[model samples]
Target: MPRSQAATIRESLSAQIDSGLLPLGSKLPSERELSELFSTTRITIKDALLALEAEGRIYREDRRGWFVSPPRLIYNPQYRSHFHDMVTRQQRQVETRVLSASTVLATPALSQELSLGPLAQLLQIRRTRSIDGRVVMYVEHHLKPEFFPGILQQDLSQSLTLIYQQRYDIRYGRSRFDIFPSAARGEVAQALTLAEGSPILLVFRINYDQHGRIIDCDHEYWRHDAIRITVDSHVAAGE
Candidate 1:
């Protein structure tokens, strides 16, 4: 049995990355260049690149070519700390951009989920988050307007949790999370600089105050390779 060309190329690139020859965030060579260098077809180069991407060693930014990936951020949905604090603690740069805001009429399902009035309108905020200069997460937030007056006038690039606490004296007491694998599409794909149908991680979360009243909900879409989820449980298995 002979080693496939794609496998050889994949291993060669991986070794370079491991040795720091291809440093983190360094863009990989064009497919044509790789094919010429490897004495292989462009399709073979594509195969190897895709394999490396799946392994989290490399990632492609749409129209920008592929690049070595940064260290994956550890994510704990159950952790109460806000994202800005967490990133600062880890010594990594994180940036949040508030893309847009609008009000939308809540349907019966959304009204029930967030306990809004029958005719209530929810304020929707769209944001994108970047880690170490690479855009990695796109979030859509829905909030009740009555909870935070003048919220839109604040510097929205800051953490929402911090804003809620400082301005409204509200805190995130309880959270419900639903995590799942998803595919990047439409606005999320554009925000992430990823091609449509790229693998993604979606987190749907609802936050409530101490008294069980809904505060807000978020739809977070993360680059599949950008996060490593960790959950610490107090109870042992099969308790």
Candidate 2:
């Protein structure tokens, strides 16, 4: 009986969301409020909410209530575009919050990937990105410090692609990419406001400079439902 009630509640809320009654990024009624309104228990309300979450209709934050999910951002890996420009073209607000930036030594795996020595210094930058005011991606980038001088002094929140081009006269060239689903944990989970073991889509990028030398690598962790990866056959110029 409770499951049926939960289903009915989930359907009702989903319809509200689809009809724009709840609106994207808008918070839903508190569980207590929902329970009282539906004459049901909090557990029943939670079941409905979880169902809605699983369907990607809504999402919750730690201690924060649920909110309507925005439309999934369409991402085409074949298109060589900056994050800011891409989000702007989609007509959604985008924000990049720099969590930390510092110089660090490259790990063995990274050294092998970038063809650098074990002790090579790298510029490590960590950021959390938001779409429509909802945090969705946590990215960690490791750049060869020698490639761009004075980059650490520049604004880290802006598009690093632009920074690489305009500041250092560097343009992206051929790249290798990898994508897979990963379990959100630790810092990535905390940045995206997801539970420790929540599912996330992980994207790895190995970028090169116009001169054919490796420049940087990025580790992108996205909320599973926040983006849709669609890559057509059209080869991008730099790819």
lDDT for each candidate structure: 0.90, 0.88
- For every candidate structure, what is the RMSD over all alpha carbons to the true structure, in angstroms? 2.5, 2.8
How many residue pairs clash in each candidate at the backbone level?
A: 0, 0
Residue 104 deviation, candidate 2, in Å? 1.0
Estimate the TM-score of every prediction.
0.91, 0.86
Clashing pairs in 2: none
Error of 2 at 46 (Å): 3.0
Weakest 10 consecutive residues, lDDT, candidate 2?
230-239
The deviation in Å at residue 128 for candidate 1 is 1.2
